[model samples]
Target chain A: MDAARFRIRRAAGGIDADAKIINRATLSFVLALLGFGFWKSGFDPTVVWRGLLVIVREPDILINDYVALAGLGPAFVNAGLLALAAWGLLRVTGVLISGPALAAIFTVAGFSLFGKNPFNVWPIVVGVMIFTWVERRPFKDNIIVALFGTALAPIVSEFAFGIGIASPWNLLAGVVAGLAAGFFLTPVARGALDFTRGYNLYNIGFAAGFVGTVTMSALRAFNVPLSGGFAWAENGPDEILPFLALYFASMIVIGLVEDEDALPNLLDLLRTSGRLVSDYPRSFGIGATLLNMGLMGFTGSLLALAAGCDWNGPVVGGIFTLVGFSAFGKHPLNALPPMLGVMAAASLTPYGLEAPGSQLALLFSATLAPIAGAYGPVAGFIAGLLHLTLVHNVGHLHGGLDLYNNGFSGGMVAGIMVPMLDWIRERRRHEP
Target chain B: MNLDATQLMRCGDELAKYLYLRGSRRVRISYDFGEERSFCAISAPDYLLDEAERTRILKVFSGPIQPEIASYYGALAGRRRDGAEIELLGTMAELEDLMVTEGGGTQIVLSRREAEYFGKRKKR
Candidate 1:
């Protein structure tokens, strides 16, 4: 049955009676972020604008927390505005703001807190538009890919600001690099799915990793020195924790209020192996999807806090990405195992669980949730363990230009583990 | 639903490969272009699809046509012969019929309506 049919069946059963409510709910969520951001800034235009200017001028590599660069007010404002713009783009393209669309939107918002920005992201988006035009295909067909492909937005920032080139030429080179990255992203992303076989839900990250590696290689060939560092805000948890708790709690409340069958539908959703294309909104109702998203948000926050990590920009961004993907793939049942695997691995390694890298590994390891959903917790645990080690090492290859470094590592883990697991399963069946 | 001719052909290719893997040596594929809908039927005369197999295949094809997923990952449909591949094919097209002939052959018909295809295009 289609989503419309599913809705009709639910309505007939006297459960979820509303249709097209997810869009309105998503719009309201964006608006609330904007509202919170303005309130936090005391509605001072100068403060917000200055913060934004600082953010846009930054190189925005890995660990460049906007909160530390500017302040809490600008970070949230940037995230909220980017999310709003994404929502508007989807609307203009006639794309339904459903599970995958929401995933992309929230990811944009999440990464905006650290890496992506309004100025750096546009070149890549325009490049995708040009690709669509050249191919003579409707941009709507590839809008989600274009949105997610902004994982390489750092490439634009790096070329424009970080590299020591003259002003106009530097800007020109950055736009050209960004355009090339975006133009090739759709094809590369589609092909990269075969490598992981859809086990890694962040396929765009995997693709961006490859593109970033090439771009980095080209830059290094010209003797361009690339440096990596961190800009973490140590005092972020005090303010961020309360906001996250309230926001997630509201999601659960709204979900229950909207659908009588939200709990049952959520259970049904959890049973499926959340492989690629496992759209919760289309399979389950929006109410259940919202509930799942809320639950996953809390799960991510709990894991980070329990590991003694602050609710910094990257941590919050990771949590938001986890929450968004809950509607598409991740859920409490499947997402927990990989996180546990990362935590367990951190205990044995020299990197303490409280370290920023370890904290992020714990949260972003949920990219391998489909492994747990498909092959059970043990496989998921192993995938997460492997992902932690590889993620830390692979950043230099892309020079921290690829924001979803965990995703790149997760793809490698899936590509290696899935084939081995399948062979083992086949051998076990024959042995029996 | 808004599929081009190449995409429709890819759908046929996926069905062909699936049937080939399931002990169908000689698969016959035909297309019927009507005013409202375009139909592609792939039939295998040599293979007798059992009740369990028929039911499983029907379940795979019974899911909704997710245009968003199809547009993103549709190219991967026929490349792998895993359950996920078949499931992805399910999201691409609507199942019209699965019939067993008197000679114990299986014919599966999948469809895309011109109205839905053009409708979405016009919206663009």
Candidate 2:
């Protein structure tokens, strides 16, 4: 555990100690979960251990990977840092580690598989730490949210690495950029919560939009164009089948463990479409939420493997992110329909659905669950379809500063779709 | 818990809108602020509302501020006899939602006079 994870002041109930235990336990358990998927898929844990050794022993591959494909181990470390960070923050701050906080932590971890890596995470984390020092609050205070604020981790990594900045200077530039992004994001996230009225599930997504716009604009001054016209991620039956089974099974176990009798209520939650600020823990208890997180992890893992995605660095990180959000506002009921819609659109369009990164975009971009949750499945489907088309081009606008690409996509989806749907409803009402 | 009569009136309006949205026929908003017994009733079913839509209002309550949104529902939940249609207008979720959106206080009422002075309102 890093200092952030262990930096809590003592609480009345000794929750600090319990939190530490749980945090470490959570890390180990999640690692085991990843290890299981990795091992099951014929990637040996020992081999992965060897791979980890290789990563530390030889840094050249990472440098080489900068342009091609970033690996997953770095993501796990990044996410692990977040989890430790969250635990530390809660312990020190004495504020409970909220569902959103937990969800955010998981999201950081999961996305680490895809876009976030330890190399990228530090600059953002350090920036947040500096924010704590400046704010005069303990670094652990609100630390949980700050950890998720790392949605911009990619900003630091890619900027430092992608800009052709070499070696020590490359990391320095990335670190500076990342910390700036992190320092900037924390307050913006707090403020954006009000605008969305907690009606948008991904407040961070909304915050990232503005952040990306600013960062991208700043980058653009140098003619560093960040966003492009469009892009798509991948998906398929293989992923769908395995993930569907794993997710449902986990849900069943969760249902059974939490309350076999809780089904009607749990099912009712599904009927709700999981709108923003939906407190499943308050409504259904933490057990069910945990079950959801586990299932989401299983499902995301299956999605990754099915895509023939390497269990390497970036991919695992992405899976962890998807899994983490499962506990926050991205339940399958709230998330999958949009995914399906995106996939459906990808199939028919000139943009071949199986195109590189298209399915990944579609799968991960389900961050727009608030659209589906608030409006129902049809709108969710539509939002997903639109999200896929727009996500690619929007990233450059933020100059890769907004690390949550889907969040950028999500903000657009929410900003546009919410009003349009409301208008449609209001028009119908007025017409009749 | 000094009650804001004006704010109470706004709460009434929101309650009215909520009732309308739920596709219910009639809703009765009431207040039993010790000496005061006040209530507002809406009879239009065309005033339907989607549960997702809500207005935030600040209410003055005494004690732990246990606002019984259920009274409206209990009043409405029974049979619609003699063209009588009734449904629960406000619920715990509404109160919690209102509290979150409004970010106000639910002051404790130690006495009736204090109730009238603090967060106190009775809709009957």
Candidate 3:
């Protein structure tokens, strides 16, 4: 009995030690990548500081591309800092290092390059925390959604910074709007999950789109002018693409070192339908999930390259978000069909293959990968086609307040297509 | 069988009540004599039971008395919900749509003999 107890203790100790090492390595990797971006952009503290100040002060409405508005250095710093703060929050909360958390953190980093900024995103988080208190649940349960739900952060910025409202009143109104958005976002997001029934992995994005639309409509009713049109940067793929490739490749190597089981579990990861609540870390382990994320990032960049698109802020943002989501529900096998479908749709339409809209369609179209997983590749392809077509029109409803416009489109597509697919299958089953 | 139809009805009532507590509204419990199994299908269109909850319930299902029905139905003489008389031993099969049950909730089919064994032993 003594020997058995000793062996058990040793085993537990080894497991704990391994977990610590892995966590340390993963955190280091993120910081190092961000540091590289900072250095590569030729770090000047004063310029970066100025850029960050501009980011916070900007109205940050939809398509208000950060790369175009601010320089690359500041945007990188914003993303890195925003992501680091989130990482620190996780550490403070004692949340386990898991796939969903990783996805959320990286998404913050990615979107910061385009839309999210530290000043704009915090109020929503605070609102989510208030929701936890009201619901009498732990904050951990909602942290991931809170991070993802920042797609609507622009609404807060618009109210505070956009309309040229007077100083103190503008600040007050913005705070109120952000708090209200945060408070209501929890229930809306939870309830909206049933609409797509987990087929659309970007569930919060779907919910936030509706929220944004209503908010924008109310603002417009009060005679607040809504801003619309495409915002993009036409430079810097040459500098950014090489960095992204090396970063992802390094992630794969690190993942292999952490777990020999990564490659084998990757097969299992691909087999999963990637429905909601499919937390990969709890099942496949972190190493394999990270490997999948790296592969996804590489593929997204490759797709961008194939389309002759420059790696601008939004493009990189879209690619990084897609990569992060791979840990949740966007594997290569499932994600590829929709990407192809977007490319196909672009060729058929008047839109140039490398047009910003088309590039966005390609990158964000992966949100429908679950449609492929649930139905078939053909269904996924159709969903992608429908997404690009719908996305162009749906932005008007929200007035670009919804940052995850693709999520809104994906949810709509899934809601319509999944039921039809189920009906067809059910009918066929009876017929045979 | 010492367990009469009334007792069986009571057992079914217990299951229905339990499933309702688990957020399933419309439940249908049926017994298959030929296959010696009992099926409980709940009309839970949006029923999502996390893994931890699933594991807890599965443990109860495989135990001496299914906890939800144990107090009233499992205390009978020489009877247990663990299916001693029935070969299935009170196990739940994988969740699926077995024969187009209402509301798309999970269907758990167990041996009827086990359910009977849950109330009373067969008397010769």
Task: Specify the highest-lDDT model's number.
Answer: 1
lDDT of 2 at A60: 21
The superposed Cα distance between candidate 2 and the true structure at residue A318, in angstroms, equals 4.3
| CA lDDT, candidate 2, residue B25 | 54
Better of 1 and 3 by lDDT: 1
Candidate achieving the largest DockQ: 1
Chain A TM-score from candidate 2: 0.73
The digit string of per-residue lDDT tens for model 1 on A1-432 reads 122223211323221233366777678778877777777888998889999999988878797989888888888999999999899899898776767888998899899999999888988888887877666566877898889999999988888888877888988988988999999988789889989887898999999999999988988898897545578888746788888888899889888878778888887788867878777776677788889989998888888878888777888899989999988889998998889999988898887687777888888899999999988999999888898888778888888889988888888898899899888877887894
Each model's lDDT: 0.81, 0.50, 0.68
Clashes per model (N, Cα, C within 3 A): 0, 64, 3
DockQ of candidate 1? 0.26
Interface RMSD of candidate 3, in Å, is 17.7
> Could you report the DockQ of all the candidates, in the order they appear?
0.26, 0.04, 0.03
Instruction: State the weakest 10-residue window (summed lDDT) of model 3 chain B.
Output: B80-89
What lDDT does model 3 reach? 0.68
TM-score of chain B in each prediction: 0.80, 0.29, 0.45
Q: Write one digit per residue (lDDT tens) for candidate 2, span B17-95.
A: 5444445455545543435433333333234322223211211110022122121112222222111111122221123
Better of 1 and 3 by TM-score: 1
